[model samples]
Target: MATTTERVKESLLGVEEDLNMSQPNRSSFMQHAIKDEQTGEEYLNEQGFINAIAPEGEDYHKIKRDQYSILFNVADRNHKGRVTLPDWSVFNNLLAKPDAEYEIAFRLFADPTTGQVDFNTFKEIYARNKTSDTIPFNWDSDWASLYLGGKKHRHSMTYPQFAQMLRGLQGERVRQAFLHFDRNGDGYIDPDDFQRIIQETASHKLSDHLLTNLPTLCNITPGSKISYANVRAFQNVIREMDLVEMILKNAINKSSDGKITRVDFLNEAARVTRFSLFTPMEADILFHFASLDQPSGRLGIADFARVLDASWHSTAGLVDQGVSGPSEKPVVSSKTFLHDILVSVHHFALGSIAGAFGAFMVYPIDLVKTRMQNQRSARVGQLLYKNSWDCATKVVRNEGVRGLYSGVLPQLVGVAPEKAIKLTVNDLVRGKFTDPKTGNIALSAELLAGGAAGGCQVVFTNPLEIVKIRLQVQGEALKAAAREGEQVTKRSALWIVRHLGLVGLYKGAS
Candidate 1:
């Protein structure tokens, strides 16, 4: 019998096969795995796990989450919440070299007190190793100072120190952003410098008030100059506004063309902000401002900055003397709400209309195809019609033009609902599969939606399709009955349904 460690390794190898991951990738994934505190079972959290194995496209995050869960479950040897060191050691030995580097990494992740590792510790170690070939194990190293430092100089970080470290990271990011805008090696940012930076980095322009009041807003006494100290004081506000602008630009510039069209702005804004912090109305208003004074409806970086500036000040209730005054309230238009509703309904409406129109136009050809398919003569020469044209000609000549349209009314009625259901259900199913965090749908979700829609539409379409096929084949049957001198009765859709039961309507549903 296999040992517990061996069983865990086997399970992990099976998961590796299931994920189609190479040995190196598998090792990397396992390195980030952490044991749950309550259950002692190994598992990877969804966010970090996704970055390791996620594929491209909307459903990538979900696929990563599922694969990670499977692998974690496999490595949890005792079916506990956490995977103990013995189980992980077995898995690591199978895929990775048991070198000094590996030993150091393991120690950094394992808790000194409990001798167990969790995802958070694993993630820290993994990130450190990824950035540098050598592990920074020295207590006095910059890495250690950045992440582990506290008043007492403990080996592990306390909660307050961790929070302080995160704030430091954010501050570093803001400082870097501020440096990017402070051109010409200047310690201060003037109106021109701000404008130039906004033009370069964003797709909108800074509002007049935001530009004029920047010095005052940053707590500069002169109201004309912005110093580094002032920027540091207002870094959080600047970072938040910059993040919003970045989100907008990324969402709009789908083609990477350095500009956004009005249509692109609207569509991408809806998608990016669907589950983001920004409300739909706010997104719409930003798009509106970005499109202002631009008849071409294409906005560049300056336009994006202007929109961001307007939105930020409006939220803060700041008045621009030259622009919208303090007395004027920010306008919240209902147009975006209507536009969202319209977008939701557009696909269903288009499908219904197209289905109705296409059915009406190609119905005669469908009649020919059905009639040709239904003919069951073993000998080719005994076939009802030589070809499609011949079949169509004979039907037109023998039954008149109206005969070809015998079942068209029911078909027309069914086509609209069938098409509508197919398209609507597909969208709905896709929405169900969307990741709540990122608002992305997976390819599997799309395929499943399409299959579900096709199956659902068949319920409404089977009866009409059956009726049409029967009517198309009726002309041949009538001729045969006449030639045999037998009394023949015409069968309508209702008559067939009554005789064969409702199941007859779904003759070829399978």
Candidate 2:
């Protein structure tokens, strides 16, 4: 029955008084301590402040009351006795409107609720606030800044930090992120400007010594804007540089005369990076590199850098001169080759075992293959056979149980060689074609090797495959036909071998 303005004003006053009384060692005049006439001990007393105030329990009630006031008001822009779509632009508080302004806007417009707001209506309330604001939200400032800017959040905020922040703001994280990163005063963040800002902030924080070394460290060409990749590359360098600077900062704090020496750098780098300097494969790869006539331990950072720089130059990309001078191509060291062989043997054994296991488990695929190959055409076979179980049952009913394992003998022999060869070749090709020095395998090489392996698999297995197909196709038709009808003689593997010869077996190959 109260007007929207009157109720809001009264609610606000009640809210203010509640907050005041809730403060430690604080109370309103009406909520002031009352003297016991006998003991003079001041006991707090006020029904209006205690009962009328909106405690956390009454929060939903207050919000509902607010919404009801809006709905009842004739001044409300939205018609149909509730907040609606067009009213969202004008109404500052969407929760007070009949239609949802934020997330509920879609739902409200869609369902046109016969129901009202509840405790879960928190999202609706927040949405009203969000849609009302004209400016887009920013994340890096409001959200990421809390963690990334401080020592607490700087090193890294884990999944918990992400969850807590998301829950605290409800689901406004994306809106907040967009608004914070919209640095240009524009509503949207363009990729270029976003990248530049990150780079500038990162570069700005480099230690003084590193900053002094920048002129020499920079491989930039004059008058050229850096690409996003180059910017990231520079950031990587800065991160490493910052690690070195952190040691100096520690030394400065300790007031030690000694700088972080090469020994110190290696020890610290190993500690921080926990560099498992030699994974068995990497060690083997490195040993291979060391075995070359050039005689290096392995591909160092510098050697790797050279390969990358050359790649960049060839691609007509912004090239870093720091990487370009001279370098030897890394070779497979003997130790590395031995390691590779050991690994290859282990994986070959494992893959063969797995393939053999799967062969027994899903041997039905072989049955399906046989039926399909035996058919005059794919569609006829598929329609006639129905499902896999039906085909199996039909095969047994017509021929016998041996029909299920038509190609099994060749398949058993094929599994080991096929799996072993395929896996071993895949590893070798991936290692070989990938520039060991640069760690980038050429895309074309990957495609070529993959296609070649697939083709070889089919080629090597074709003869056995043809035998299996012939066995699966056999039935009582030829037996009956031979006895009386004499339409077509049933063909056996040997019969086909004698009549059509080896070429005849590979009928499906073409």
Candidate 3:
């Protein structure tokens, strides 16, 4: 027996299926151009914006409408109680830079009076951020000829024209992609073939919903191909995905479960979102069709992202990520084992150098302490040194400054292995327990990592300490050496290790 999904697939085709996809729970998408009371000119409000991108059939694939409830809030960003063309332009960084970054940069490179920059200044602008190793910008290059009106030095550009030039570069590439699919140069690309261009350029950045439904809107019959003009409009919407996502994210509180019911999303988005790109109906329809996973309404950022963005998924899974805690993390990391090992090794190397340096600085003090504890004197008056300072000074005077650092070799050597092993063990273990999504570890996992590191440190540190003690005690004070013909043979680190043997070195390890 065929399943209902299989029967639906068999029965529905093209326009019929697309129409059925339109949600009946909300008002049908009706385009009503808003008139600004002061200007007496009708401007496209949020409804018009959604219509431009979504078209007639399969409106659920588009954004939902706030059903006139959220319109005033969405359109009021321009202060004219509407979303002006300039507001859209600034949000997209089209026509002009919002922060005046490129404008200020232009002024610096251009003549203030003429408001124009010559070919030299233009190349200088390009070169300002380039490294010496980067290929130099050539005025005669093919890209420069196309973008800068040939190689002529006579071609000077102002900030307004420069902004368009920068903007057109991306559009030109999209056009080229569209043209590639338009094999006959008929100015139309097949819906299926045109999708290839979007897949190539935008798949990684665009949401799955937009990519699937956007091409279906381009059916103009004859051959059911999408026009270049329609493709251009679609391209424009793709550029605004970032701004739309930013606005949508702003509407929801991340600290919550991150799920907003359909009405709540529309109303909340009304409060937070700028510009009138989505109507209440449009948003409601999207919430119905687009949200992916939910027992409490599937309207998480990921599902909303199916309508909104592909850039930053979300904070918590439902909002951006999870409800109460991190839930989106994969059990295994994407990083290769070799990569994790290399990263651990890098940190361990840095830690070892730091430990060795610190140990070297304080080794002399350790030498004095070792000597003070080891000294044998029957009477209090026959004591070689009274305190830490006296022992340090007496050793320097007797042993010609080198005696105070008698066992520094083993101390420094010991520190390197101790730090290296401890850090490597901790890092490897932490990497195992860390949440791949957030890179955070649980409190229990952190404690385990630290304990593992400490356990590993004993392997190298114990033998090193044994060798260190041997060297420190070998060096004698001047008064101790004053006994005639009483020779105290000094052993090097290698000699001590050789005599102690592998088993003997760890004798007093505990």
Candidate 4:
């Protein structure tokens, strides 16, 4: 019956284990600023802070100076030339309110003159939040007590506690994700279903290959159900992905060669991130997965980048540049013969593959339909083939299972041109008839496209249909002749072609 706020507050306050918002999840500028400080501890002295934030080169003049000074002043309330850890932590603490409004509460409830949050200030913030529409019921004084306790000294909250609350909220989101995929009310999710969960929830953390095969990692056996513990471990990867990318980028930039050793990666990952990001075992597996084919077994930025996606790859070409160019463009057609040939070949191959696959899959069924339609009543040489199944059974009994696939060669031969011309003609006609603005065609245009496609396909399909039909019924003809005491002659495809000649094939054409 506990609400989200209550759960998060409890987890942050209590010894709850699941909260995990890694350092990389912070904004890029903040991460860079924190990195620049280089203090072994969380906060730096005022001079060290200023030195870290401001630039030192030719470009470090009024514009850049003014920007960094404004940021420094926000943390240094009361115009104190010295900024302490509390001042810095409380200022950066604004970022900790990912779900709930600790920022608003901090601003409203902190002492206006003294600017410190005590138990009294905390209670007042709770009272105000209680009247409002946010911060659901059951979130209470317990979190404040535990956080303000310990070496943090029960005076006021610091950045670590605030971050803890944020991580706790993230943990709840992870649990909700688990429940979402566990649709059968079972304790665990199937491997196939686990793939959906990992992709939907943590796709930003991994490569496409890892995203697809993550269920394999979660499952004990192939196609088995996934446990919540495994799901948690899988979800944990993304929390460190951003950190991984930054460390890798830094390492590669520092190196002469573009490669990084596994030891360097592990050291950097641990140094930069808050969590036990990559256990020794995990580091070994990650290195194994991302290893190159070389004897050194080292990883280049390019190789590792392939296996790590922090959601930063962009297809937007280059940034807009030199914006003073002319707006007008030439209207002449720019395509060459080589371009035309390549496009034509591409379309031809597409059509051929589609047509061949279709014919190959269903040719047996088409053969049966052909045999049924071509059946004729003869006093001396007739076979009483009733329905489709009866016809199929008879054909198989007389000629074997291969009989069901009779005449497939000519069918495939006919289909290539049939689909190719249909696809090309339909696209052309539909494009011409489509509305210029909306790119949609009217019903009349659609009908016209369909008619053109059908008309063009008939040119290729009719001749082949005749050939396939003769082949499909050839077995029945021989069997009937044998029963009727006549010569049982077997007809070949080349014989049928010669008998029909070029013109004879189109005997019943429109």
- What are the runs in model 1 whose C-alpha is more than 4 Å off? 1-349, 376-380, 435-439
lDDT of each: 0.56, 0.43, 0.59, 0.59
> TM-score per candidate, in order?
0.39, 0.33, 0.39, 0.35
Off by over 4 Å in 3: 1-332, 378-382, 477-484
Query: How accurate locally is residue 131 in candidate 1, as Cα lDDT from 0 to 100?
Result: 38
Candidate of highest lDDT: 4
RMSD of each: 19.9, 26.7, 26.3, 22.1
Model 1: lowest-lDDT 10 consecutive positions: 318-327
- Report the lDDT of model 1 for residue 433: 84
Supply the global lDDT for candidate 1.
Answer: 0.56
Candidate 2 segments whose C-alpha is farther than 4 A from its true place: 1-332, 335-344, 372-387, 398-402, 475-502, 505-510
lDDT of 2: 0.43
